[model samples]
Target chain A: MQFPSLEYLIFFPLAVAAWYAAAPRLRWAVLIGAGAAFLALASPTHFAFAFVLSLVNYFAGLALERWAETRKALWVLLATLAFDVGVLGLFKYGNAVLAGFAQLEALFGVAAPPRVLSLVLPLGISYYSFQLIGYLLEVYWGRQPAARHLGHFAATILFFPKLVAGPIERPHHFLAQLAAPKPFDPADVTAGLKLLGWGLFKKCVIADRIAFVIGPIFGHPRDFSGLPLAAAIALYTVQVYCDFSGYTDVALGSARVLGLELAPNFNHPFSARSVTDFWRRWHISLSSWTNDYIYRPLSMVISFHTSWRRVGTVFSILVTFGVLGLWHGATWNFVLFGLLHGAAVSVEALTSRARTRLLGRLPARVADRLNNVVTVVFYSLSCVLFRANSISDALYILGHAFVGIGHAAPIGAKRMFGRQYHILLLGLVFGALVLGRWWTRRRPVAARPTWQRWPVYYAVIAAIVILGLFQVNQFVYVQF
Target chain B: MTPEAILLEVNKVFAEVFGNPSITVGPTTTAKDVPEWDSLNHTALIAAVEKHFQIKFSLREVMRFQNVGDMCALVRAKTGG
Candidate 1:
């Protein structure tokens, strides 16, 4: 069920209540059972796929650990990864492949592509699959042990809150939490509930509200000039962050309420001062996974083939980002998005020292501010590729974003805001998010009294109640 | 190479790459303690260490090192000093 759905609203509280009512030893059983029921509700047919995927990874990890010889472990690990990738390909990309074949047939005036059994994507396939792969690889490399308990491993993959979307917990961090007994910590629960409310505010009040404008602009990019399109792009940047980060907060909060500590996913990514820093803050789990598995290994190969001081760095960046892009989806747009980021980062890597040298004469704060501006602009431009539906659309937006600068469009402020001042609302919400994060980061918390804290808490609660009463929206990252 | 001499050269490389004047690193020091010691910097640091020590780190070793001490001990083990 969607996070905003009445079904989820009812189900979440009921699940939490039932979970705590059960003995500590049986809490996991309650969660798994409820999570299974929820999965069945979402897509009963695909629930089996998740089960099988988890089983495969669990055994694969065991095999990797048990094998005495490194070569045997390596073989088992590769075989397991292949199987997981095969399952993902079949369910996720099967339709696209069939459609491509059909298009080819029509172009040739030949027979049409056969109608294959279309399978619905199981919830959390992309996330769990990646986690499974990382788990097996880690075990094979002796980074972590194989999880002995099948039930615990199953819960790791199927936990309801993050089952649909995730912060993508590593086996080491997540499994350890799973082994601990559930404690009824009122403070943790309170913090978790507050985090959940804040997440909902981001999704419903900020992201969904912004989507009203962003959706229209993307739909008809040709009609909108530089100003509207740029506005849409800016709004989209916020929308995506809120939607994804909002989902993570809820996921983490839910897990927190259950006495499980999930990792924080987003860290005010927009405030990142470089593409590399952006990756570090945004979708941290995925980025770290890519770094450990893809970039490091690939870099080693590149370094071996050529001297470390020479060709390896550029090659590694391009290849790493290319793989990263492909991982997001099969679309050409994602590929270009990855390449643009890769190129930007490679350029950043190459010139950082020289740039630092040139800027070294400036005051430290001044240099930092200048660096921040340059990085944000660069990162935003790259995001044009990410937000656009197609490569052509991306090119069009970039072309206009650059060329449409001199001439302002004739669109009214009211219309631009959408009906009910959504643009203004989106701006205010986004401004509040950035400003609050900045304020929190800048201010010393110990200096603030409880009197200062209570007002902020009340204001946040009021905002959530206000937003929830009016509307709710699905998080963006659930699709991935 | 003597372990002490190898360490001195490696220390020099670390100081240069990290741009720290008085790093005073011990074997126990780690990336977590160093501001500039992120993934990209880690890779550069490894390369610099390799050049200075004349020893190559396997992928497993590179990935597994927990601290500067681990790296130093590993390097020493490989070099048989």
Candidate 2:
């Protein structure tokens, strides 16, 4: 069952009960059962693929540990990378590869090959593959010893709360908990429930609500431009943030309820002052994963004590981002989105000294303020590619986003913004999230009296009932 | 090299890598202490430190380093403190 689904709403409590009721040594079995049940319900027919991959990674980790002290381990490491990356490439990008060959044939005026291939990327292939790779790398590097228990490894990988999409749980974080399972704690459950409520509000009251407004525009981006397109850019930035972050909160909250902690995946990313800062703040798990595994290794290899070192470093940035973008989908648009970000980050890096000297001339506070606004606006603009149907559509939208900005607001823009009730719903929820968080930070909500808690809780529940777009829409990140 | 002597050399390495001549690094100083001390510059910083000390760090040794203190400790160990 997916997070926020009615089925999940029923399934969760039963799983919790079964988990706590199980004997201490049998907890792993209980978790695996729960995880398998979840996969069956979520992707009944295709669930075995993920389970198989998990087993493959389990063996890979053991092999790496066996050769941990010898260079022969490098062969195992290479084999693991090849196997994991090969499987992902075959399933996830096989179609795109075929399409490329067909286009090449067409270029020489040969008859394009008839293509009869269909592949549904195994659920969470991109995510689990990375986890497996990370796990193997840690073992090979001697940072983490290989897991002796197969059941613990399997449960960690198949953990239903994070399997579909992920905060990309590390072996250390998830598996360590399995070894020293926590007793059922009421406090953790309460905190987890609170997190779930916040996630629900974000999804139903905000993300899904805005999805409707921007759907038609991105669907046929060339239909209109000017303020409507500009507004779409702004709205979409919000839409994706709410959708992805909303899903992560639910995932983390669910894990917490089970007495495990998942690393946070977001941190008010829009507040970042630069593209590098933005990457660090947004999708923290993915960004940090790439930083450690992709960027660090590449940059280290590329950098030498020569003038070309910087050029090689910048090239790594481009390639890493290109790969990051492609990881979203095997499409040109995602590549562009990643490179756009990579380019910005590269420029920021190359100009660090000049930028520092230039900014030093201005008031430090004002310079910081200006950078924040500039970063958000630039990111919003780049998201045109993230949401657009194709490269041409995104470019068209960008070309005309500000074409008639000084003129009166266009009718389409007016109508989109004039969804008064929806706007009100968005505003209310956004205010509640921001202000409630602020207030809670100053004064903890749980410490407050029952009289106060009941009303606030009722208002939230009523808001969900009244404002929620109740349906079984998958989270945005689930597509990746 | 003593730990204190190693820290002074490491501080010089940071200054050269980040181009912040006034930079100072203490035992407790983590990457968070300097905004410029991000992943992008981290490799260069490591290379510079290794060059200055004529010592090499393995991938594991590099990954395990948490702060300036860890780097200094490794440097002292390698340079026979």
Give the best candidate by lDDT.
2
Candidate 2 Cα outliers beyond 4 Å, as residue runs: A304-307, A405-421, A427-447, B2-4, B20-30, B56-61, B64-81
Candidate 1 per-residue C-alpha lDDT over A110-168 given as tens digits, one digit per residue, 9 for 90 to 100: 88547775577778888888888888877776767899988788878888888877777
For model 2, state the Cα shift of residue A48 in Å: 1.8
i-RMS for every candidate (Å) is 1.8, 2.1
- Would you list the clashing residue pairs of candidate 1? B27-B69
How many clashes show up in model 2? 0
Error of 2 at A205 (Å): 1.0
Off by over 4 Å in 1: A97-117, A402-420, A427-462, A468-473, B1-9, B16-21, B51-54
RMSD, every candidate, angstroms: 3.4, 2.8
lDDT of 2 by residue, B33-58 (tens): 99779888898898888889998877
Candidate 1 docking classification: acceptable
